[model samples]
Target chain A: MDEKKLAIIATKGTLDWAYPPFILASTASALGYETEIFFTFYGLQLLKKDLDLKVSPLGNPGMPMPMGMDKWFPTLLTALPGMESVMTSMMKKKMASKGVASLEELRELCQEAEVRLIACQMTVDLFDMDPAAFIEGVEFAGAARFFEFAGQSDICLYI
Target chain B: MADFDEELDASGLNCPLPILRAKKTLAGMESGKVLHIIATDPGSVKDFEAFARQTGNELMESKEEGGKFQFLIKKA
Candidate 1:
């Protein structure tokens, strides 16, 4: 059977939110499928060296620590820690312990697996991002081109 | 092969990884070849179940071990 093409549209900017697309795409590639990830809006941040680790705690009441810390100081306490790495590291470790690969490894595998990573040029300018800040091997495209890319996908996921 | 025909040791992988691997592997097989996949990721349990339903893959068996998950899938 011919391998199907898969596309994952990433719009979330947080580290936790960022994992699914790379994970799915890399996994798809491992399965011998053609995979692509179109990063737009906040999703573009994942490719940026500086913004790869920041994540919002929305929908996670148990987040921001101490088990009930969000209630007391609010999730703002998460900002107080000032280290997205601490939370992100813990989260990645948890995911890894569950047999999930780390985000860094996943990204590498996605690249190695030939999962094409495309960044939306419009969103880059909208957010005022430096194209150089993103990881290597990313191509810039407009929505029309992305639509054409996505139209060929057998499975398309938005995460 | 027995009714429980094949086994895939895919422990220590998470979420879409297990299912994606399963799908990729399944796409190449003759129909009705059963595959059993063992995984340590809880998310894979749900992921595989949903994948089976969406893609018309048949899940012949599923189980767990101290946080690990096992599946018997028949390619459809």
Candidate 2:
């Protein structure tokens, strides 16, 4: 049998949304699958050097309130300035306490496992993001290049 | 219990960590050597099964006791 391959498209830029693609890609690589992640649109923010990722609760009805507080509290807080950054920090702390790997650690493990991280060239061009702005080991590729890998992948995910 | 060449305690680690650590451990071991892993995550049950299937490794034993999941994997 041929080797299994997984291709993931990451389109969301939130700190919360960043975990799935990286975790999945790294796990797939550990499982002996050839894994690739195509970062597009806002997702390219994750590749930014020294990026301070944040999550938005303003329009997210599903965003959980801190300390099991009333939903209205979080809703009201979201309307206030700088609340998203507060929530993002709290979320990071919560994840750390729960033994979840930080985004940086996960990315390092992915690199060691040789899971390919591909940035969407079109998005980079649209955002005027310099290649030097991205972290080391990130590759730039177009949608055509992404589809080439996705076409042969056993699993494809849009996260 | 069968003899295992290595033992890793992955309890309290969440999704993907246990599997990733196990994969790294297996990479440094000789073929046919068994690795015993104890994980607390419920997801590890499916994760280990899938890991073994995809990597062509032998899942020699798997059991759940005292809310902890145990797996013995032999490198291919």
TM-score of 2: 0.93
Q: What is the TM-score of chain A alone in each candidate?
A: 0.80, 0.94
lDDT per residue as tens, model 1, A1-159 = 577889888998787787888877876675557888889898887787655565545446656553555677555455555446666667766666777666777687688677889999999888788888888999999878778868988998888
Q: Model 2, A1-159: lDDT tens per residue?
A: 567899999999889999999899898888778999999999998888776898877888887767665365646667788887788888889898887988888988999999899999999999898999899999998989999999999899999
Candidate 1 lDDT for residue B10: 76
Q: Which clashing pairs does model 2 show?
A: none
Chain B TM-score of candidate number 1: 0.84
- Runs in model 1 deviating more than 4 A are A1-8, A24-35, A48-52, A56-64, A74-77, A81-85, A108-115, A123-137, A150-159, B1-7, B23-34, B53-58, B64-68, B74-76
lDDT at position A144, candidate 1 = 84
Candidate DockQ scores, in order:
0.36, 0.83
